[model samples]
Target chain A: MSGGAERRLPGHYLKSKEMYSLPGLVEYRPVARYLFSAGQAQSRFLDGLKEGKILGKRCPRCGRVYVPPRSYCEYCMAPTSEWVELPGTGEVHTAVVSYISTFRERMEKPEIVAVIKLDAPGYTKGGYEFAGLFHKLCNVEPEDVISGRAIGMRVKPRWRPPEERKGDVNDIECFEPVES
Target chain B: MRPNIHVKNKVAVVGAGLTLFRRRMLETPRELAWEAASMALESAGLTLKDIDCIVIGTAPDAFDGVHLNGEYLADGAGGVNKPTVRVYVGGGTGVFVPIAAWWHVASGLCRTVLAVAEEKMSPAHPHPQGVFAYIWDPVLERPLGPNLIWIFALEMRRYMHKCGAKKEDIALVSVKNKANALDHPAAQAAAKITVEDVLNSEVLVWPVNRLDISPVSDGAAALVLASENEARRITDSPVWVEGVGFTLDNTHWYNRELGYPRYVQYAARMAYKMAGIERPWREIDVAEPYDPFDYKELHHIEGLMLARPCEAPKLLKEGHFNRDGDLPTSPSGGLLGVGNPIAAAGVMKVAELFWQLRYEAGARQVKKPVHRGVAQAWGDLMQAGTVIVLGN
Candidate 1:
């Protein structure tokens, strides 16, 4: 309202068809592909996944364990020198029911996703940092999530068949509830 | 933590401007940058000739589908033949833009700096959400086939569970922010909505409905920063950049607790200490915490120490965060109501504080006599936190 100028002028709205029909509109699809090296620590961790085992790197200086292991400790900035085999069983840190896929495509049956805090000995209880993995959850009803029963519930990774295993995060089919 | 060295000259934001936030625009990225930069210079009573340096901030190149976005936007940002640099810290780039410009003036390296931020999320095919896939670790996170909202949903769920807050409690932020946006000219998704509307909206993830999230926007914002001497010569009411702080946490986001934003808290502490602010909750009069999602505003409000941990929801219910409240937040409508153009959105928040401090915000100005204000942005796999404190 200063200087007698009004700030509200609606922007030009464009329809999809109008945008496509505009003159000098250039559309080019980018085909960028990548072959990411899982790196020193993560490579070993993924290899362990294929062998039906979970791996974490422990910082020698600060004794912090990292799943999806990094060669360098983020906190202590020291080289991670020890590879620790984890129990692969931990409580569900957080969980959500995903009704859609990566591309925003709706699925017939909603999928349950969660961050599983794998049991590692480095950090204390209620610590900020932990050794965790992001994966799908199974054997838990969607109602369990809506009712606040899924979070903090004990869970373990359900590994795929030995012959069908691959050296990737998906080697473990998904994390499932550990029946008490 | 106190800073190591003292800067030779003080910095001030003399002018700020922003283009309309929309889903799609006729103008290209550079054109949007130029339009906003021109407006900022005009408001500052300066021209490109007076600018000695330029700082441009933009999110991933994948969003705009243009590589080297900084060099591409140089001319439009008035960087032609001037010392120009582009800074990126995921969504934190918006507030980081002015923080970088502050150094240029405070170091006595430049008399005046033109800072610009722009993001165009429309060019990405399928949807901009598809481009966001690039932000995840290709080997680990992408293999899970996760949408960007999955992270936010998980974090929101964690916040809800830890705070014992229901969906209705979090929905109030969206309702309040969208209603405030009714006065924002550049707002893209401004509406008079109720908590029921938010609950009934299309459910993307379990807890995050369509109404809880900010719209994908294409827009630009700019600010003119000058040394104290140059600022006094250029304008009568230059908003001083009292402090600037930014921090990046480890990228192993899943390995950490999601309920609290430790990174944002660290950054806010850094800025507050530099500003000589002992108690942010009582010292700061207003704030513009990034609200790309409704719950995020509450998360950041606590991280910024504007409220005690888990106290934002209670305060929010009592109209403590409204435009007319004692400590109004996001008076210019935050990204939830205004548009979220990533980097541009953060710049827009800082720009709102600049306008509010000068009492030039017109209808969006808070009722309280504002002397100190804070703006913050969070970005990059929930790792980056950028904060700036300003005063009239």
Candidate 2:
């Protein structure tokens, strides 16, 4: 609506084809390589995953437990002092049906993802702070999530067979309802 | 937590400039910075020589596929031999640019500073959102394999659940902001869209239709900052930098309640205190809260104390956030309307506020007589909140 400047601002908007076809245009791709270090606490947690167990670090100063274990408690600014094995069971906090992958590629079967509030003694129910793990959910229909029937339902990890365990998050195939 | 109040000099913004926001641009990242910097200098009746120092902000270098992006953009930002510094807080980098420049003048170190922000998100292959593939934690979250939209959808769902906000209510923000963008010359995604259009648009993730988000854009924005004496010499009507605030919360975003942004509230509290405005809901005349997502605008409004928690939906439905409403927000169409180029988008919001405070914003100006305005941006895993309060 400003006079003399309508449809005028710096920079050029490239068309879809122009991006690939335009000569003198630079083209490159990310080589994609990463080697991440799993620190002392996380390495132990991974070791637990290899044994079909969930492990968490308890901050001695704050008594708050962190799943996927951080070496230090962010709140207390102190090194976590204790390791506790979890029952590998929790209730669904929130779930969404994912129709696309990391690259935005469509999937044949939509996957249900949920953040499970891992069972713990110290943390209050529905409190702001809690030890949780984000993972896939199974044995539930998309309708259960859409209808708000999946939340607050207790679920346990569906672990892969012992021989197939790789000391990774995928060791647990997915979390499924504990009840029938 | 209160910031140190004592400062040597008062700072003001003298000029601002922006480049067109588009999905893919022909110009290089440095070229975009030069264009915006040149325009800002030209508007202030000063050339690159007049700038004392430089403060540059850009998003993660991953998006542009270039390492050491700030140094690459230094010359274009008018930084050649002078001291040039780069600051980044993801999407919050734009507003943080001015905040960084404010310190230069406030510390009595640099009399005139050129603040610039630029982001070229198109160079990344597949989609810019793929950058998250690296940003995710390798051991914990990455194993789950999440698309970036999943986080936004999850938060939108949490907001809907906590505030009783329906998808219909949140869709209104996209409708309102895109409609407002139609008047903006630099707008990329501006359109007169309806809420139904948003509802029917492709749902990339649940509750997050394509229209519910700002487009991936390539653009740059710049601002000229000066000490009070330098500002008075440049222009009679200068927008003083009344206050600047920024804060970062713990990275454990999932541990906290997703409904409200406590980090932004803490940042806004700091900014409002510095400006001596107790009641932001009433004192702030016009606002441009971050709106990368429709619900985020409402989320930040409450965090900024412009509305009580869960009250933004009711206020939005009443047209209270419209351009002509009593407490108009995102009149520059915000990130939703303007286009989200990461860092540049935040600077665009501040640029719009600069124009609004000076009565220079032509038709995009709010109807109310405005004396004070605020612009904010949030980024860095939904943790960093940067705010600036400007007044004539």
Candidate 3:
């Protein structure tokens, strides 16, 4: 049975309010580590990241190249053998402005999160899906994000310094819009 | 056409029970499960000893602050030293609990299966919001310092922008569901509120608001499932478990159109096909689409094919989703009004449908007679959908 809204304690209401407020709990635990399998194909993909280059695996059955390097093709379920380098330019599909931190507390400065649709050739089966990744949008105003102009805008990865490259997912900094 | 499924025996839900949906309960997680499970077994005219096997569903163990929580709750759920299986699919675990039991009885694996679902969000130190951090990408997404509401708000905004639904329009769902919860004995947020109340509530992230969301709750719900032979001998009006379905989409939630829930549609299709239901909007007499957030009810109603995409909000405004309306959605109130104990909240929705189909819901009964009913739940990065169909 649903709890009566009128009988709801103030704590209930307050918790709901906490989601958007600033200074929220930002540091979360426990630490999580994910292991990536660097098989013959992903090893080269990892090597490319260390050298500040984006690499993908190509499937022979469907002739598709997958970014982030997959050992097998999702669509054809065939083994991939070729490693392909990409231009790393794509368009933003959606974006949002976050005033609260990851812990549901408020933040002094709001951050903009955007989903970039990568320009991988034959990445998705019919373009309904894509080789897109979620990341922060640099050099974009919150108003631009809210106005829907941030979407469909061309963007390129802003990589970190060459010496600072760690062969990790965060090696490339936020993605920035490519000006005409 | 021959059915694509095999049913060794008929399965019926004999009893159901739930704990008070509270923002925070003093009782421990195991205690909450025991309280709800005891009540369900007592209602079924049985005891823990009569249960041949047990099936339990709890959302993420993170909320309870204990990993492998199913094992931790086994004794309290009355599964000690008995064959037990814990199933999880985000919030869908509530109905999935019974579905797990359905297979046990339907496949001749057990005669009586006790299904329990529980969630205690209060145990998480500091604030439960910290638990949501793990749901995002640790390498890429988390470094952006994103709040959990961002994803939900993004989807809600996209749904509203695409469906031509106004915030005020979706507020009616909050109003109706909350009002319906007023009659619920364990309701946490049941109230007679107006759309203005929802509109005036603090906006957390543009589209999402304080009132539009369900409270983090501590509670538990349980159900008893039995084979046809055991069901007929136990009760005259056993609610039959007709069909069940679950599906998951890729983790790339934003890659696809946010207007429609393809995962929910796929799950609903699988259930309807098994139940021999050709037209859900016309065939199903009643429904409960998961409503963790007010707009989620409308989103899931479309996902369940109860209404076409972009139609739920309008239909809601037209009184088509009220308790006395043509097709009552969430007649037992919903997560918005009921209080969301995560996994337990979903199970409560399933139990409400069981009560409605059995003609046992006294004050909270829908206006019309119900021969068949459906309950659907969505969870996990907006990617998982679970559907269950029940009939008399």
- Using TM-score, give the best candidate's number: 1
DockQ computed for model 2 against the true two-chain complex using alpha carbons: 0.57
Q: Would you estimate the TM-scores of all the predictions?
A: 0.98, 0.96, 0.88
Cα deviation at B26, candidate 3, in Å, is 1.1
Tens digit of per-residue lDDT, candidate 3, span B68-98? 9999999989999999889998877777788
Candidate 2 lDDT tens digits, B1-392: 22468989999999988899999999999999999898888788898889999999999999988889999999999999999999999888989999999999999999999999999999987687778777777887788888888877777767877788988899999999998888788888898888899999987777678888999999999999999999999998889998899999866666667789888999998899888888899999999999999999999999999999999999999999999999999998888888998999999899888889988888888999999999999998768999999999
| Residue A33 error, candidate 2, Å | 2.7
By descending DockQ, how would the candidates be arranged? 1, 2, 3
How well does chain B match by TM-score in each candidate?
Answer: 0.98, 0.98, 0.98
User: Local error of candidate 1 at B220, Å?
Assistant: 0.6
Put the candidates in lDDT order, highest first: 1, 2, 3
Per-prediction tally of clashes = 0, 0, 19
Please give the C-alpha DockQ score of model 1: 0.62
Candidate 1 has an lDDT of 0.90
Question: Over the stretch B195-248, how does candidate 1's per-residue lDDT look in tens digits?
Answer: 999999999989999999999999999999999999999988989998888999
Question: Which has the better TM-score: candidate 1, or candidate 3?
Answer: 1
- lDDT of model 3, residue B159: 78
Off by over 4 Å in 2: A1-7, A124-126, B1-4
Full-model lDDT for every candidate? 0.90, 0.88, 0.81
